[model samples]
Target chain A: MRDRVELLRDMVLVRQFEERCARLYQEAKIRGFVHLYVGEEAVAAAVMGVLQPRDRAVATYRDHGHALLKGVSPEAVMAEMYGRVDGCSGGRGGSMHLFDVAHGLYGGHGIVGGGLPIAVGLALADKLQARDRVTVCFFGEGAVAEGEFHECLNLAALWSLPVVFCCENNLYAMGTALERSEADTDLSVRAATYGLAAWSVDGMDVDAVTHTAQRAVEMARGGAPCFVECRTYRFRAHSMYDPELYRDRAEVERWRERDPIDLHRTRLEASGDLEPGAFDAMRAGVDAAIDRAVAFAESSGLEPLDQLTRHVYAAGPEAGR
Target chain B: MSRVTCRDAMGRAIRRALLEDDRVFLMGEDVGRYGGCFGVSKGLYDEFGPERIRDTPLSESAFVGAGIGAAIAGMRPIVEIMTCNFSLLALDQILNNAATLRHMSGGQIGVPLVIRMTTGGGRQLAAQHSHSLEGWYAHIPGLTVLTPATVEDFAGMLGPALADPDPVLIFEHGGLYNVDAELPDEDPAVDINKAAVRRAGQDISLLTYGGSLPKCMAAADELAASGIEAEVIDLRVLRPLDDEAIVTTVSRTHRAVVVDEGWRSGGIGAEISARIMEQAFWELDAPVARVATAEVPLPYPKHLEDAALPSVPAIVGAAKELLGRG
Candidate 1:
């Protein structure tokens, strides 16, 4: 059995880190579309728990939680939010484009549905090179409407590529609800139409997400692409700029009642997985980590303007000549 | 040396690349079983098998983006779009991902992908299938745009483009696919960076590329008959244009006429004209002139299509006008 306490700890860490980010945004410390994963922590924590170090991942813009869970340092992620040189993307890509190639996190793609084809190609490379690795591409419900979604799914299934398409259906694609965008609201069914094994899981429950993702990862490792729709909800507005005009206050309140962290903590406590003061100690540790991240972000230096165009092309024999 | 068509030369290039590198593969619509829409990959499928000579569905965005992904993941994938007209479907992947990935990822990844597409118009394919759009791709900063106008270039450009660290787009003129040219036994190593001086003259410079090169060469012969020596420069590389070559030729001749198959306004000819004005203003004996396609959708009729495209007469007229000898 997997450690329920560790899962709970990760979710709590994400929650605390995002809450701190919200306060920082309010103070004008972090700029440019800061998308918080306040309530969608369980999906990232659980899904990432099943991925090995060798496996690759491609995440969307609201990727702080995914990056952190995938082994990108909290300090680097926050520094990226601060647009500091020490950030994972060296301050070139801000919050919406966190990238850590060393950790196998491909990128935080800004465009919707942009990562799907890249994921397929990555899987194709592994299959061609005879490497036993899986590439997990995480996109939102909004990405399903893109032509690339259908095209990539067909290609992946046709090639039997080692790819696990993780759709974190947090209901909103920017302010538009999934039901409003998609005529057929069932995402897993749409993925199944591509002829790959597809299913959905309870995104709020860590155990459910982990169990479902583990099976999908196994299927991908066996050279069959699989799709999983994580039915989750984002508690906060889509971004710092969103006034949330599309969502109702009552709906947000109702979804908050199923807050992933609270449910996981309650489950752990009921199963005797937590000691009397364990939750408090874990919270304290998470708070300290967030504080350290904030300090690192604040103290980090900005990138020099002269080096602005350094990475436009890789350093090569004829590059920049 | 042996004579070969541009089609056979390109097929030879793909075969050579596949044989030389275990990581290289070809993927595109109708590239495998159907032998490519233009028959550029006629026997590659049978030779390399389905895994390497992959025939993809008509999903340009996915396959092109997949090529970029495979390139980043340590595989050299040469993706072909049937024609430049259909390449608009995958422009998002080419512009947003392949061109931006290395810089956006803080240089952690490089897309060593090569995309080849048939461009220009000569067949009665009409508007949708006929139009030169290489100038559009040339506008993007991170992309390397190449227009191979010779048989050696058509056969040799692919190797260096695949070896490059960034994305390279090769635009093969549709009309030149069947043109015959002699290839040396040991094909001279072609550089995608330099513009080739196809013919040398001293009276005026005729600058052109791709489908316009032959017309410009013919115009030079006609000009020579009129005692006007026209220097012919084939602009093999479009992006990071050989500005030095352009300026040097114009400096010697002191006059220039740019010929392009694309529309005059905002076309590559316009860019070359502006570069001449910027860098060779003092060297020019007369104003730089341009011969380009008439700004209309290419027609289906042969006579009207020929009239609309940049012709030898148009290049000769433009050169005479630039030299004030009309």
Candidate 2:
């Protein structure tokens, strides 16, 4: 019970930080396509509950929340979003690519469905090297239809690689809804056909997601792969460019009424687990962290223009020959 | 040392790579149980098992990306795209992820991977399977493209390519796979970084690579008979071109002809000509000439395909024009 409240505080911090990012994106402080995991906060918060620091986690472009929940500093992520050299990937990755090798956050890939196979290979290496570490890969329901998604799941199952394939079903891929896009709306069933044990959890409930992910991770570490489909919603547009022409206003309002952060906070307050003072402190902490991150990013130097062509090839001095 | 064919040389290279390093493995459609579509990986499946000599589904993009991921994670992966033409399916992986990972990661990761694809025409495999796309990849900045045209290169270049930390594309000629020649008693391993002069002359220079090398050499032979001494330069490494050798040869010969199996406009031949002009424009006695494939899909019929691609006669004709013989 105590652990749940602590994790709830972490989730609150991530949610508050992302809400600030949305404001920043609108204010023109952050550029490029910004995809915030606002309604999907519980997905990261829950997954992080089961993931150890030694285990790996790779997510998609909507990954700021995941980075924070996975133990990466909100400041580093926000700094990366600001494109500063002091950030996690030296600001080269920007918002779409948030990689923290120190925290086992392999990357925040920009390409759609690009990180699934990479996560499979990471698990293969860990298993081959005889490590007990498991790699948890997070992608949206849109990725489930990709050929790479199928191939990666098949390989993971066949090799019995230690990997947990987490699908955050946000109901829409950019503008296309799950009903309009996937032939099989039941993503977990689709994953089950690949010989993997699949689970579908209510992504709005952080406890449900946390419990489901814990089992999946345990199963992966037990010499097999597992899949978890977290049924969630994106409260905002897919990116800044999206005009939100797909869904009805009523649908948005309905999902917004069940916002994951508010739901968790309500549950905590009703159960007498969290006080108003604690919530105020958590909000202040998140605000201060975002402020510091923005300052750090502004202070960090930009990479020199002359070094743009550097790291194109791994060959150092001899490669020039 | 045991005598080996080009096919066996590639096999031996893969074998040596696998045995020497636990990280090395082979992956491609039909590369495992079917023995590589061209028998290049025969007997490897039984020896290395399904784990190493992996037979992948027809999903080129996924497997190729997986190969990149594996390489990034410290494994030396050799991804075999049955033909360079099929590499188009995996273009996103090759061009987007594999090529840009090093720069995008801010030098944190390097793709220590090799993508070996058979290239060039002459097998009557039609348009979809018969084209050479090495020139397309060469235009990219990060990758090192190698065209090993001889039995020696087929036997030798793999070690150095695998030893290098960066990505290397080995374009094995589709025709040269069977063209056997007497190899040296010792491993006459050559440098994969420069152009090798196959024949020396003082009149004109013929620059070519891959399947076009034999035709250029034949043109050089024919030119010799016609009292036109033509130096033949085989460009083994295409991307990081041997500009020094090319400039010196063009300066001395005062004439040059580039023979490529690809199309003429915006082809590797054009790039080479542009580079020559950039470096040694004044030294040339005449403008550089080029013999390339006719702009059309390569047909399956023997004669039409032969007529479409650059031939020995075309090479000779271009060489003669450069030498003011035409």
Candidate 3:
């Protein structure tokens, strides 16, 4: 068992990274659509704890937390968000399309529900190759309605693929609430309909998300893919540009009171696993990391127009062959 | 020596592919115990078992994406859609994901997946089931399209397709499932990226593939009787189209006729004709002619269905027009 100090540090790091991204978005340093993974740090930090290095993960637009926790360099991810050649996707994909193949991070897909099948495919590959790797796919409540989601679940259940479908029920698919969108609000029950085991975990509690995801990931690696619905809420607006007119401010404030980062801090203090001085030190370290990532992104160069069509076709001098 | 149909040749090719690589597997509706909708995958389930000859739910997009994923993971996956028409439902996975993954990943990943599907109309399967969209797919850069018209093409293309580094889409004509011919025991291995001259001649070049190849061959025979001596070229590979072969043949013949069962406008025939005009314009003695299916949803009536698609008479008529014999 990891000391509460390390778990608290992980949560703090993810929270700081997301807070920095929100600042960058406001400052206009990172262009294109930016969806910050704030208020949902527990989902990534906790789930990533038990993910083996060989395992793969796919996330949606709200994916910075997932990427950072997956061990992709903060500098590389921020550089990608800034559209620099040194970025993971080489600036081809902006904030919403960050890809780090080296870390087995498939991407931060822009399209809702599009990444579900892709995650299943990755898991299917692991099963076919007889590899002991499991793939964890993360999506939002908004994705439950898409045909791609249901279709992939059917195949995954039918073949018993090694995948853990983690639905971060942030309660909104853009501006629409889960109740307004899905006929069945309980997303876990839908997975059960497909013949796979399903469960719901408190997304705001890091330990809860971690423990539940560990069991699901184990089942997936053991030969049957599993589905986990993390009943969480996003305190921030859907995107940097969203006016957030769909939901009430009181609701956001209520969820914010149960913020996962603050909850972890309190738990650490109560358990005598962390002193106030140590917590302050961890925040300072996180702040320094964020500063360095911002500097790296600022110094990184932009791709030239001559290479606009470079990766569009898989052949020639520009194909990065 | 053994006699086999195009469908039988495809089955043998699949069996050989399965034997050659344990990674090679078939997955689709009725491809296993049902022996495929057209029986093209007949007897595969019994030999390879359900593991290799797996049957999938009616989720074209998901399964096709899975095939792409499997291909990238170092396995050879052959996904079959019931027909070319239904592939539209899987277009997101096929075009956006499978076709673009190689380029989008900047060549870090290449999908060696093969998607086989039925195409063309003659069975009166109605509007929804019968149509050819190979021409639209040929326009894409990353994918290679093939239409195996001859039994040799059916048998020869699979091995090479399985070896190619990129994705390959093979359109097996539903109308030609029962086509039978004497296939030589000695395998005449061929490339999947080149066109083949089915018959050699000098007066005119008749270009076609899939269901229209036999019609072009019949037209060639009739034109030969009339002393036109038409050369027929079967385009086994659709995309990265064998421009050299078509240009060289048209340059020799100096006149050309294209036969396609797709619609006339913006069809594969239209693209072929445009290419001939651009590359071999000076070699041509007259304007190129074409025989394409009529522009309409294929109706259920026998005569309406027959009238909606290209036939032997249509190809013969187009050839005569190009020869100024009409």
Best by lDDT: 1
Q: What is the interface RMSD of candidate 3, in Å?
A: 3.5
Model 3: CAPRI class: acceptable
Q: lDDT tens digits, residues B1-326, model 3?
A: 69998899999999989988988999888899999999989999999999899888888888888888788777899999999998998888777777776555544667888999999889889998889889888877778899999888888888888887788899999878788888987565988768889999999899988888888888889888888898999988788788999999999999898888888899889989999999999999999998888999899898999998988887778778877788
lDDT tens per residue, model 2, B1-326:
55677887888789878988998889889999999988899999999999899988787887887788778777888999999999998877788777776766666777888999999989989989999899999888778899998888887888888877888899998998887777765456779889999999999999999888888889889999999999999999987888889998999998999988988889999999999999999999999999899998889999999999999888888888877788
Candidate 2 ranges beyond 4 A from true positions: A316-321, B184-188
Candidate 3 lDDT by residue in tens digits, A91-113: 67777766777787877776677
Enumerate residue pairs that collide in model 2. Answer: none
Ranking by lDDT: 1, 2, 3
**Candidate achieving the largest DockQ:** 1
Higher-ranked by TM-score: 1 or 3: 1
Cα deviation at B85, candidate 1, in Å, is: 0.9
Q: After TM-score superposition, what is the CA distance of residue B221 in candidate 1 from its true location, in Å?
A: 0.7
Write the candidate numbers in order of decreasing DockQ.
Answer: 1, 2, 3
Docking class of 1: medium
DockQ comparisons of all candidates to the true complex: 0.73, 0.53, 0.41
lDDT of 2 at B48: 92
Q: After superposition, how far is residue A241 of candidate 3 from its true place, in Å?
A: 3.8
lDDT of 2 by residue, A1-321 (tens): 227887777777777787888888888988998888888989888888788888889899998888887888877888788877777877788888888877888778877778887787778767766878889999999887787898888888987889999999999888888888877799888899999999999999998898888899899999789999999998888898988988888998999998888898888888989886777888787788878877777777777777666778776533533
Q: Which stretches of candidate 3 lie over 4 Å from their true place?
A: A1-4, A22-28, A301-321
